[model samples]
Target: MKTVQVNIVTPDGPVYEADVEMVSVRAESGELGILAGHVPMVAPLKIGAVRLKHSGSTELVAVSGGFVEVRPEKVTILAQAAETSAKVDVDRAKSAKQRAEEHLNHPNESDVRRAELALKRALNRLNVAGK
Candidate 1:
């Protein structure tokens, strides 16, 4: 089986690095699937789950927002924030989602846009965590 190197980097550190059979992510335009020998490209990522497939195993990572750069043999993700499924705190995400939702529902236009973004990020994390 063919594999490509995938690295996911965050501000804190490198969150994930592996040689995987395939990677799928939600780009700003639409869904993207990358495999070995894919043409070089770049895309803006959205707040959603990143799916990696390798050797009969599948891993899920939640990304708040990011950019993906794909080379012939490598796929690099520079994310604002990312968390693996195991590392995601479901309870915390739930609480955050509730808080953001409340903020969005209120008439505080000053922070409403920020709150909407927070809600999306929280929901993305929860979805990736299987909550």
Candidate 2:
């Protein structure tokens, strides 16, 4: 089976590095599925799960948003924040979701947008964590 090198990096450091059969991610335009010899391109990523397929199994990585650079044999995700499913703090995500929801209910104009983005990030994390 052919594989592509995938690296997920954040400001702090690299989060994941592996050779996988395929990679799927939610881009700003839409969801994209990439194979070993995918065409080179760059796209803005959304706050969502990055699904990696390898050895007939799928792994998930949650990303807060950033950009993905693709090459024929490599994919690099430079995210603002990212966490593996096992590394997600479910309790913290839930709390953040709740807070965002509360803020949304009575948000000031400026805070409304920020709160909405926060809510989206929280929801993405929880979803990726399978909560």
Candidate 3:
């Protein structure tokens, strides 16, 4: 069986590091699926959940935004922020979502985009946590 070394890093520290069969993430172009022996490339990632497949199990991780560096033997993710399902607090994410929505209602032109991104990050965490 082939495997690719995967590492997910955030400003705080490494969120994940492992050898896996495959991984998938939301790239600027869309969802990009990477398997062992994939072509080398670099892409920007959107605010969403990244899925990784190991032997027979899958894990979901949420990232606010990031960049993915792909190589035949490894894949590296540099994320602005990241969270695992077990580490996420559903209530907190819900509250964040609500706050973001409220901010959007006020519609500050300068902060509207930031508010939307906050909502996206919260929703991504909720999805990863299966809330």
Task: Return the top candidate by TM-score.
Answer: 2
Q: What global local distance difference test value does model 3 have?
A: 0.94
Candidate 1: which stretches are off by over 4 Å?
A: none
Q: Which residue pairs show backbone clashes in model 3?
A: none
Off by over 4 Å in 3: none
lDDT of residue 122 for candidate 3: 94
Q: Could you give candidate 2's per-residue lDDT for residues 5-82 as a string of tens digits?
A: 999999999999999999999999999999999999999998899999999999999999999999999999999999
Off by over 4 Å in 2: none
Model 1 weakest 10-residue run by lDDT: 104-113
Query: Which order, best to worst by lDDT?
Result: 2, 1, 3
- Pick by lDDT: which candidate is best? 2
For candidate 1, the per-residue lDDT at 16 reads 95
Q: Output the worst ten-in-a-row residue range by lDDT, candidate 2.
A: 120-129
In order of appearance, the predictions have TM-scores of 0.97, 0.98, 0.95
lDDT of 3 at 13: 100
For model 1, state the Cα shift of residue 41 in Å.
Answer: 0.7
